[model samples]
Target: MASKVIHAIYTDDDILLQAVKQVRAGRYHIAEIYTPFPVHGLDKAMGLEPTRLAITSFLYGLVGLAVAIVMMNYMMIEDWPQDIGGKPSFSFLSNLPAFVPIIFELTVFFAAHLMVITFYMRSKLWPFKEAENPDVRTTDDHFLMEIDVEDHDVNQLSKFLYDTGALEINLIDNK
Candidate 1:
């Protein structure tokens, strides 16, 4: 079945919560919801699953640290042992301060670049991509909910939306 997109604008958070509660009580299916900023407890009300970005970030950071360690050890110890000013290149255990800059820089480099790549992939937001945002006002001051309902209940859905404190309601047919 095709989807019918609806836009609902709310004045404040309370009205939005009331509308969500009413929809949940009626057992209606909600497709997506957009808000200018996060509404507290909204995820719990919508029954969304926890995000996995944190785990991905941690793993990426660890990989970066491992790469930094191996690269530094190989370059400084085996490949080209530079005896600058008679300073031993065997181990950085004594002159740890000198290695601090490289270690810190590599850690930041890996975490920042890799995490951003992961986030973009996870959100399906690639460079120069256009996403289907139903309403432009949704990014600013409006709260919008896209709901799916039976063909017979299109008018009923509109009426239900208005009664539940929707400032303005509009529908679009998605084939």
Candidate 2:
């Protein structure tokens, strides 16, 4: 089945944000938005759900912390008991203060790297992937809002978008 969509382009982010809110209030379903840069509160304006990446980051950090603790304990306490500064304490619990920095660093490192990987995977972004934006100009300076016009009147939608400050509007049949 073929579908038709409207691409509304805006020159500024502020206008785009307001247009999104107005369109949603008018019961129009927005397909997606493309912007040159991140617009603050744009997701909220578009009524998008909150991301779950932070929770996953915390879990990754915990795993990293556990790995760091176990690796440190095995290497420092069980494998080779180092008598540093003539203080020979072959116990992980007793010498935990000395491993605090390593634990913290590893936790942060794992969380940061894993979060980036997760984001890339979730967004389906990878090497050799083709660009999906309909307009290349959106990548430089324009903000675009795509609207599905499956059952809606294209003329009415175009008028509504134009009234909402869309700089340009184009109706395309996505077959």
C-alpha lDDT (0 to 100) for residue 89 of candidate 1: 90
lDDT of 1: 0.80
Q: Encode model 1's per-residue lDDT on 32-115: one tens digit a residue.
A: 888888899888777779888888777877888888878887888778979877878988575466777888788878888998
TM-score (all chains, Cα) for each model: 0.84, 0.94
RMSD of 2: 1.5
Worst 10 residues of 2 by lDDT: 85-94
**Cα error of candidate 1 at position 14, Å:** 3.0
Q: Where does candidate 2 clash, by residue pair?
A: none
lDDT of each: 0.80, 0.92
